[model samples]
Target: MKNYKFIYVLIGLTFFLSSCEEWLQVEPRQSIDSATALSSQEAITAATNGVYARFRSVALYGRDFLAIPELLADNAFNTGAGNRLVGQFNNQPGSHMGNWGTAYFTINQINLILRALQEVELPVEFRNRIRGEVLFLRALLYHDLARVYAYDPTADIPGVNVGGVPIVTQGTLTVAEVEYPARNTVDEVYTFIYNDLEESLGLMQNFNMNRRPFFVTRGAVAALFSRVALYRGDYARAIEMSEIAMASGVANFPADPVSGWRTQVQPESFFEIVFTTQDNIGANESLRATFMSRVFLNDAVAASHGNVVFTDELAAAFPDEDLRRDLIQRGLAVNSGVFEINKFASKNGVPNLDNVPVIRYSEAITNKAEAHYHLGQFDLALTELNKLRVRAGLEALEGITGPQILDEILLEKRREFAFEGHRFFDLKRLGRDIIKPTGNVEHSDFRILANIPNREIETNPSLVQNRGY
Candidate 1:
């Protein structure tokens, strides 16, 4: 923890870290000024803000992880030329699958804060709240890494010994500690992630943790556990956790569902990573730069910079009556003919400064619906799904009960989360083939799993690359 630690102090959300240049390098410990930073409740809070800053970078939720998954799946269409994110899929996996660096950097910051909180003499509530939030963030990052970089534990062909990302609990202080660490098995990493989240739940009870979407509250922790359980195929646990989360008031839809997408912090959001003008990833190269073009909507200041566009399939499949369809815009791409996708458009009239939702009420409901369908509670599953349908301004279906209901729930999930980065992982969890029109992908295709970044494999010879990369 000392090695990755820095004097990260926040003055009104602007973090000033000491020795920032070597934050991500492989070297021995330089004694961190842990005393100064962990000395008070306020300083520790500042350190936690630094972790949020790490999350807001381009590599994590700020851009690549949030936007690229849709491109990898059928949610977005390639613009035929000069769309580099589209170009990434055509490029080799070894180079394009590059989420390792930013993810670990965020994880490292969380670990440092966790370690610092251990000895700090803060009030009990503050200490526990800080600890719980850091633990939740840590689990969240590891979950994404395992899902994207490793084979799912439930993958049919996998044995118990399949590789996952390295399980780094505490931050490393020396080159020898993590420079050559081998990958953990998929089960081991998942176990590690669950342990952190479970512990976080205990520490977070009734503590709203700022009572806002930016921090993961006790209810959000429950929602996250429900999500993890559903994805991990623990259907019974997911159902139970989803009930707890809903009873905790975490699954209630926003009062204004249509405006929720463009609201800075949607009311339905359980946990979000916020961006401000001070820390905004700018217009030229952030999410707005890659997804939408700003124009013609009577808002020129927040015009879109187009990259990926909605597929004709997505546009047609998303029912016109659904308010979500309004989020999609009909516009021309710089590279292709007229197309549409406004899911990532600016919310506050500034390009690329929109907040990113990590977990939301609709997802909690999605988890509940899926879990119920898996457990043969077909009526309950349909009821949960109908809530989302009605919220989207669609009429609820009647008498659709039985195993076939899973398809309904899945389709609802796709329509609800179209560009919010759920498509690829959802297909993986279902063990289904990805079928895009004029698409060559099939079931059991090795490329569905991306390869380890070549640079990572080069640095650590012990790491195993994914199949057929």
Candidate 2:
């Protein structure tokens, strides 16, 4: 294991130095005093916008979380064929420093904003809206961190108060806060997330949600709450919150692939991290760079530097008539037939300008369906699954009963949200092995969770590495 100091000093220096390839469009911002920056309404707004810019950084949604989960599971394959790191995550998962460090660093930025906002003199409506948005984003970040780093609170692990990353909410104002923070329990983290989302909802309710899909809204809070509840096994709450979200009229499953998965945000996306021509994270490291064929990303060639694409096993999982098949590119002559993940290809005819979807409406229906199935309401579960299927013009699921309904629901989710970061979490939450569609994983192996970055443990003696790492 490597023992390196946190170069956060350098990180702080480069925090505002945006290159042309970066996806977020924000003005250059250097570090400023929390009190001084927060004193003005304009400064508070910029600080809040800075949170989104940091969230979209390369280590966060820019690549690791959005694309790597698909690589970790079976939704997408590293075209490098074990030559590089995605293969390592699939074959034998280990320390994911990019995801771990970036998550906390992003969290620190949010905390700074929160602390600053407390003393700022802003209009009540504007203040509520900004604070609510930050809270929603904070909840979302913690939820993902818990998913990757810590064991589930409901897992059969034998420890009380033992399943979380460190709970660092407020900015580092004291030595005790920064140097000696202990990990919170998974239950505590979930509690924190739930409370944050609830507060976000209450605050956001005061404002009209006329913002773009890139920004958080009341619907996003409800949607995230539904997901958190589902993860925590609160089936009734999941159903309730999901229904509330579905009623918000922001998300839907458009039957076609071009709009359903291709267009970043239509009626279907509750929240998306947007990229524009002025802010595209250039060709090499973009989602389009990794997923689509080179020709699709920039018309470079038929196959230049083909990185990540759909495995044939994944392709066969979808039925012939499903529009989701369009999410996977086909009909190319290379390799007997070329197949690529075409979901994130350039939409506005500009390379790498695709918006990353964070929350969508179809998830609420499926989440509610799973909750219903878990609560033994099999008919209701099947009804919800049919809602999604019928939207895509697929035949309704009938004759499904008992545990098969759960299996069908999961399969439907795999079809719907593959390459969008749900496969690994779903499998882990359901207590299934990480067997891929291609039958490549080690059987009965429990290496589902990512290892805590070695540097973190070395720096903080209190931090515990995951078992069997």
lDDT for each residue of candidate 1 in 280-341, tens digit (9 for 90 to 100): 77765567666766632334443445666777777777776888777776664353354566
- Pairs that collide in candidate 1 are 292-305, 293-304, 293-305, 294-303, 294-304
Q: How does each model score on TM-score? A: 0.87, 0.89
Give the alpha carbon lDDT tens digit for every residue of 183-260 in model 2.
887888999999899899999884435777778888888999999999999999999999988887666666664565
* Model 2 misplaced regions, further than 4 Å: 1-35, 81-84, 95-97, 154-156, 159-162, 173-177, 255-257, 262-264, 297-300, 331-338, 437-446
List candidate 1 stretches off by more than 4 Å.
Answer: 1-35, 80-82, 89-92, 95-97, 159-161, 176-179, 295-297, 300-304, 332-337
Best by lDDT: 2
Q: lDDT for model 1, please.
A: 0.71
Candidate 2: residue pairs that collide: 163-186
lDDT of 2: 0.72
In candidate 1, how many Å is residue 405 off?
Answer: 1.2
